[model samples]
Target: MSNYIVEMLNIRKEFPGIVANNNVNLQLKKGEIHALLGENGAGKSTLMNVLFGLYQPEKGEIRVKGEVVKISDPNIANRLGIGMVHQHFMLVDTFTVAQNIILGSEPKKKGVFVDLKQAEKEIVELSERYGLRVDPKAKIRDISVGMQQRAEILKTLYRGAEVIILDEPTAVLTPQEIKELIGIMKSLINEGISIILITHKLKEIMEVCDRCTVIRKGEGIGTVNVSETNVDELASLMVGRDIVFTTEKTPAKPKDTILSIKNLEVKDSRQAVMVKGLNLNIQAGEIVGVAGIDGNGQSELIEAITGLRKVESGEILLHNKSITHLSTRKVTEAGVAHIPQDRHKFGLVLEYPIGENMVLQTYYQKPFSNFKVLSFKNIYQYASRLIEDYDVRTPSTRTKARALSGGNQQKAIIAREVDRSPDLLIAAQPTRGLDVGAIENIHKRLIKERDKGRAILLVSFELDEIINVSDRIAVMFDGQIVAEVKPEETNEQELGLLMAGSSKEKAGEL
Candidate 1:
């Protein structure tokens, strides 16, 4: 009998113009937390989708507990005790937690309707058992992102998932939530459940995974024991290069203030106060990083600056000129560039071609368009230049923006925003879901922009990025700028404390 619980041999999946997975093999041992490590488009998700029955592989053999099986759909995979939690959740917003969790596998009371009471009771028990606390009666739309993720995990476990697949589970979570998730994974593994975590975060893999299988450009590179390998080795295996974790750049030469937010008050779409009396200043030739836990007014502050959200009061100035309540186009015209936090939401048009998306902000200007008539020739030429320069891997500039991988999409946004050479650049979560190579490239571009006298406001939850990329760091807590400190004067520990509302002297004492 084989010790492996699940085995996918020589899997081959192809899409139009791209071979997603080519002869990729994955073996999962019983009762082990394994990591599927790779770049964004390196076929990690494709291989998992093949296993979860979302896509059929043209060539592969799947074995479950030493028995060969054919899985053609999600129902079949569920019957075979395989469950997957995708990066983007699949939940009905109108449904309650219990409703979403027990949708297909609901307990019938009278063989006619769902047993709501029984389902809620069972959900409570299951959540307690797994330490995934979620209100059973809470609506999905009203709950936080972390709670929704927990509900996703519960959906899999409720269906008897002996072998679970988690795809980038910690990407959107706060640092606190990530620690809780790590604890939950440990508890699940202790209870004899196996997990295959699909991620590129070397820190999480090293801390949680028992072993790791690396894939690069649709082919399996190798697998190594987590305890025996280091982060640098894992990074090299994943990206096929010696990864420089820290970006090298000269000190900032800050001059006049490029952007100033004085007593800014902003509200969300729901009319809730998010950014309250916030004051921030960014000078030319410097990067000012806003470091905070997620939901601490970062999104609202960025939106307020970019003219996406309404300012309830106060002012935003670009180059000493008031830009508060200006139209987005007006703000863009005033030499402001924004790489929004949610790429799909505000950055790109999914239905448009990659070339058209490249000139979204500047298309109405010269060269791209004249008298409201777009010039496809110039658009494609410009996109081609950016694609080559920024290393945006795509079939062609004619490809739809939706067809590109997350990292590639992010790269395209960076190319479009950075090429404009604006005076003040707002980069929000610039390297959110990219691999080491792509991250290094993006970081270099940001620093280069700063060196060229562009004032940059970087908002990121990644502490390392905030520390390494920014010359000055502002710690935000509860919709306010709590403290300002230089990178050289603080560590992650001190910054974390300040972000949580602890003063410098208190943090030092702690």
Candidate 2:
């Protein structure tokens, strides 16, 4: 009998112009958490999709428990005890948690109507068994992102999945939630369920995974035992270079305030007050990073500043000129650039080509257009320059934005927003799903922009990023700016406590 629970040998998958996976091999031992580590476009998701039966591999042999099997579709994969939780969740916002969990594989009553109460009971039992605390009665739209992810996992378990694949699972979770997820994964393994984790976070792999398989540029680099390997070696194998953990920068010479907000109040789509009575300022040649747990008014504040969300009552001044209640276009014209938190929702048009998305901000002016007629020649030329300058790995500028990897999409947005050289740049979760190398490059670029006298407002859940990239850090708690501190003087533990509503004095005491 084979010790491996699953084996994919010499997998090859291809798109129209790109060979996504080439001779990639993966072997999963029974009940072990195997990590798939790679760069942004290094074909991690493509390989997982093949395993989940979302894509057909041109050449490969998959063996489950020493017997070869052909998984032609998701239903087949599920029947064969496989399930996948995608990076972007596939849950219905209008459905309740129990309804979403038992969506497809629902329980029946007397061979008639759907038995929702039984489903809820089973879901509650499963959640408790796996240490996943999710409310079955809550609506999907009302719950937090972490809770939504738990529902996704419960969906898999509800279908009797013995093998689970999680793609970038912690990319949107907070630190505490990530720790909880690790515990859940451990509990699942204890129950004899094997897991395949697809992520770019080396630290996560080191902490939870038993072994790792590294892929670079669509080919398998090698596999190593996590117990014997370190982060440096794994990073070098994935990125083909020695990655730098810290950013190089000089002390900021902050000039006059370029953007100021006073008594800002904003509401969410549900008309609930999210940002209340907030005050802050970003000076020229400085990066003011807002550090907070997710949903603590960070999203609303960014939306209010960039004109995406209406401010209920407050004043926003750019260059000492009031810009309150301005339209998005007016905000852009008034020298404000934004790298939005949700890239697909606000940053890029998925159906458009990468070249066109590059010129989204300035296409109406200058070389890109004349007399309201677009110049494809200048537009593509500009796109090509930024693509090369920012290391956006794409088959061509004509590729659809949806075809590119998440990190590349983010890079394209950063290139577009940063190239405008606006007076104030708002970067929200800029490096959410990126590798260490890409994060380093973006950090360097942001610093370069700061050096060029552009003020930046950064908001991130990664406490290390707030400390490493920002000159000044603001902690938000309960829709208000609770405290402002220099990054050099505080540590992540203190920041974490403050973000959780601990007073500065209490943080110091801890």
Per-prediction CA RMSD (Å): 1.3, 1.4
Give lDDT tens digits, candidate 1, residues 21-129.
Answer: 9988889998899999998789898899999999999998999999998899989999998999998789999999999999999999889888999999999999999
**TM-score of candidate 2 relative to the true fold:** 0.97
In candidate 2, stretches whose alpha carbon ends up further than 4 angstroms from where it belongs are: none
Local accuracy of candidate 2 as per-residue lDDT tens digits, 216-243: 9999998999999999999999999998
lDDT against the true structure, per candidate, is 0.92, 0.94
Candidate 1, residue 339: lDDT: 95
The per-residue C-alpha lDDT of model 2 at residue 286 equals 99
Per-candidate clashes, comma-separated: 0, 0
Model 1 misplaced stretches (Cα beyond 4 Å): none
